[model samples]
Target: MELTAVHEHVWVIRGAVNMGLVRTQGDGLVAVDTGLDKQAGKTLEKAAKEIGLPLRAIVNTHAHADHFGGNAYLLSRTPVTVYAPEGEAAVIRRPMFEPEYLWQGASPLPQLQNKFLLAQASPVHVEYTPGVPFEVDGTTFLPVALPGHAAAQCGILVHDVCFAADAYFDPPVVDKHGVPYMVDYLATCRSADSLRSVQAAWFVPGHGEPARRPDAVIDYLKQRHEQAFQTVLAACRHPRSLDELLADVCRARNLAPANPGAYVLLRTPIAAYVTAAVGQGRMEIIMDGGKLQFLTIEK
Candidate 1:
């Protein structure tokens, strides 16, 4: 397991779903986020042993399987308190399973299916709410509320570190058109923007390396998002089918057609973008029978 010190007290285990360990006061340990599968448990255990800290609590940023899949393994072996967003706790504790998070435009993996099934066999007990402050093992944690990405995702604020989950990635992921995923662009921007008030010196992302100066990344993502939103609005001068809009947008940006599932995956965020734009009077949606088409409102 490759453990990198992201901050003074926070260490990141770079694997499938970067796990974090933060040392609290009085030799108490806080497991910020767990990895993707059972193998992640082994890696976390190894890292914990290296630090010689007892794992007292595990705080999940959200309910995504990638961030919480190892819950069963970690909770089973250690007498640890597991915490998650209130909206996600019920789903996590239920022995049944849902898709967890939807992925569009990606190849299906059978291994993921088996892992979800295995995780459903047992549920963890700890849960929490946004903006709520609590203490465990001598350290205080403030759950910063961030919506749009996930309903109840909370970025953790501890000893000069904010574990900013998917709200912001270190090296932003470009879309098929070399554009960033700005579906919830505005909300995500606001979330990161609000983080400016936080006292943290560094921020850790779920999928990428930790960030010291996230201002540039956040700015780029916001700019790309506004550009994408404006582009969609310009193309919607006349009513356009979703497929037509996707094609026009994809072509104007010169995106490739490699994955068949990309279409489905992009729809959720795209629809959200359209919804927000429509609400703001930048665009409007017309429903003909069951078919929905979008048009830009002329200024």
Candidate 2:
């Protein structure tokens, strides 16, 4: 809701989910990722107007509802082209796919159909290419792939500031969530490495304050990632079903999925850890009495 200038032309609208704005030639501006819903989109539009920067385009870093939910509202108010990564474009256009995909291709339960999972549909006019610079009126935004938070998720770089969209979480936020959500554990690590390699004057995370020394943040996230993986590994000392594993991990971490919705959401990142463990040959899947289970690999 507050616009803090990161550079002369680059500003970040600090909110629960940070949105970026880059002033371009003339009165035009490029918005990088909207907030959680139509209300958030309206706030962004008003904020831009207060600063005399009219929106010209929208760049969605990924398809997560919280990141792109404001797209529909913004597009409805102005004629702006939307740019999104290829793999995420479909979900942005068909927001329901998010919950459905999370439910394993089955009809999502009512709890899974909330605004956090399903956003209103919006048109995507451009498919972003990672590691390439996307030129707006007179500014260039370098789209850096930062997947694992979501497939094809990316960060936008402009005016010496990098808008890292959920590639990593703020330390306190990570502690608050207990286990940060990730779809691919290895990819998350790679994204952290990618962020570390970027030479920028400042780095802005989707959910935290912008930092001049992003390495410190990245290092903390790396430690958390390793810890979460180890927690899952220890939870799998004996054969356990996915649900059982999830419960044990949550119990050890003092995390309680208070509702069905929370349970489904928390299941995702834990499942990702299981997938990564199996892929790395540290865990094995077995069938026991018609039940699928995961177990630690015997030495």
Best by lDDT: 2
Instruction: Score residue 214 of candidate 1 by CA lDDT.
Output: 72
- Can you write out model 2's per-residue Cα lDDT over 117-223, one digit (the tens) per residue? 88999999999889888787877888898999898998888888998999988899888888888889899989988888898999999999899867888888889
Model 1, position 125, has a per-residue lDDT of 62
lDDT values, one for every candidate = 0.71, 0.89
Give all candidate RMSDs, comma-separated: 3.8, 1.0
- Model 1 quality (TM-score): 0.84
Model 2 lowest lDDT segment of ten:
132-141
lDDT of 1 at 15: 63
TM-score of 2: 0.98
lDDT of 1 by residue, 166-264 (tens): 776554364423444334555776886776676778887776667776787767666766676777888888898777877777777776545533453
